[model samples]
Target: MNEKVSSSIPEAEAVIDTTPDNGQEGRIIMPEAERARISKESKKEEAWYSGEPFSSWEEVEVAVNEGLLVPVADSDHYKVSANAVEGGRYLTPVAKKMLDLVAGEWSKKMKKKGEDIDSLFLIVTSMTRIVSYQDGLSKKGFPTADSSNPRKSTHLRGGTFDLAFKWLKENRSVAYKILLEVLRDLHKKEQINLIEETTIGVLHVCVNPDKAKRRSSSRRLAGTGSAKR
Candidate 1:
């Protein structure tokens, strides 16, 4: 690890670690102090774009199925219940279907390692739209809001949601890794142009499954990139 040896506990700026990508450096950097400041401001920024206060977050366990978790169509109230997405807006019909595909794909993989694939949740780690509207898009446990959208706030339009594993033992579910591979594979076969996402190895992936993959194999065949967004 290329330790920069900052004099003190510098601020939390965007860091460019030269490790994960085979010694390749990160594309961004932030001073330690700037990081803390941004983090403080991130409280209200919205989860999808930037800040997410972990302290204020509450983690709860929920179930996942091999189908869409939220509802589609328009309604005065959220199509999905507050339980599914968690403390945010409701899940779009598209988002629900995506959640199911991920949960199922991950579960099947995790089961091999004795992981509780079913004990997953539609985490709302940031970008809290509203209570009743939340379909489990948590406003918790994110570093800082730095996207065009930001975290802890609503309006994370497009079919996106934060997902993660809860009671796993010994090792993190390899299912997460599998999920990425499947996604890349789908990108090849289906040409599903899933863009502007963090390849940050999240325990869960927030994506639009309908156009992305199917629930059956979680290995939705990748299409061509001809439909690049």
Candidate 2:
């Protein structure tokens, strides 16, 4: 584990208001074609991880206990928002690894640039959510993918999380740019899917679960072969 960074960044400087407001006045609506593509790909990922969405907090707890889901806490590379994600900060083991990889890469890049890595960290505004919580967001008229079908939500699958951009840009402009660069590199590598939700002012990220599964299988096979020696 890396050295934990101090959470001294002012709340006002790190928090973003994600609450719904008036109609989509200045919000950037995703194109219908692009939206459909993201949904289709995300649905495939959901199926790969869990066949169904977590229906309640109890389900989440069961997944955690079964080692299917892991708790995501504030780390040196990132901070979990206290207000935005009310459901719970949890993610699949593979998703947590992906998040840490991205954050670690960002830290290395910042260090190479002679930047103060201690003062720079990504802010995760959202994580896993129960079906009921998804329903509440839908009732509030928030833009959610397949709100009517909670199982289609990637967040419920526990492989998706939102990174705050508005607050980062407003407070730490330089760190914001570097973080984008890191995400772009990872996106190009097909290690993750990145969705810039301008409407909500956050970057929605979904880790590639299929690839992780393949890697896990490969490791298991190798271990078994070595054991047979």
Candidate 3:
């Protein structure tokens, strides 16, 4: 530990002694302001560029096989055709909302910029996965799969999903800018966790399940009340 003498303790005798007999209780005494600053620095939030970390990949696979994960295609927020990509198509409700919010915001921003937006389609790069499937992908040296653990991936639990930048770009340079803006907005609101794999050109995001469920319930109640009126 680099001990810098604080301005509050000018005298050499007042310096925090590094005597071995003092034990763990021998901590430096500083002004209340300095103490608060140290406390704040220690409790700072983690950088927003990484998704939720998981342990015990086996448990995640169990959740997937038990049919606990919900399908994203069932949600109204996203558009899926009969030719949707195989696998990774399913996601938890919360993840679905995160995708929807981003897509919706992206569309709105494009429209505001006076760009034609009708031809664009939001692509779902990866979704729910099983342990075996993830393992196979990892063995093939897939970039996204390499970052995910077969047993611990949020994909297995339908809690996470990925979107490729190419699909969003669709030949438009501003697509990624819109994506970043949407991510910033959602993350600020604590609605989703996001990580941009710049090398792979993919955006990996996960929504908070608790927040999604509560919002869904509130929407339902509001709809019912409106109907009664």
Local distance difference test values of all predictions, in order: 0.32, 0.68, 0.48
TM-score of each: 0.36, 0.76, 0.55
lDDT of 3 by residue, 28-88 (tens): 2334454344233222112211233323345444444554444566322234433333555
- Higher lDDT: candidate 1 or 2? 2
Residue by residue across 92-111, what tens digits does model 2's lDDT show? 78888988988898888878
Write out the backbone clash pairs for model 3.
57-151, 57-152, 88-127
Candidate 1 regions exceeding 4 Å error are 1-89, 110-155, 165-170, 186-229
**Whole-model lDDT, candidate 1?**
0.32
Best by lDDT: 2
**Model 1 TM-score on a 0 to 1 scale:** 0.36
TM-score of 2: 0.76
Runs in model 2 lying further than 4 Å from the true structure:
1-15, 20-50, 84-87, 147-150, 213-229
Cα displacement (Å) at residue 73, model 1 = 17
CA displacement after TM-score superposition, residue 186 of candidate 3 (Å): 1.3
Clash count, candidate 2: 0
State the lDDT of candidate 1 residue by residue for 1-229, as single tens digits.
1122221111101121111343324233334565455445433222222222222212111101333123233122112322333433334344555555544555465556564433232222222233223323222222333422233332233234443222111123354455555545644454232222232222322342334433212221111111223
Candidates by TM-score, descending order = 2, 3, 1
Please say which candidate is ahead in lDDT: 1 or 3. Answer: 3
Better of 2 and 3 by lDDT: 2
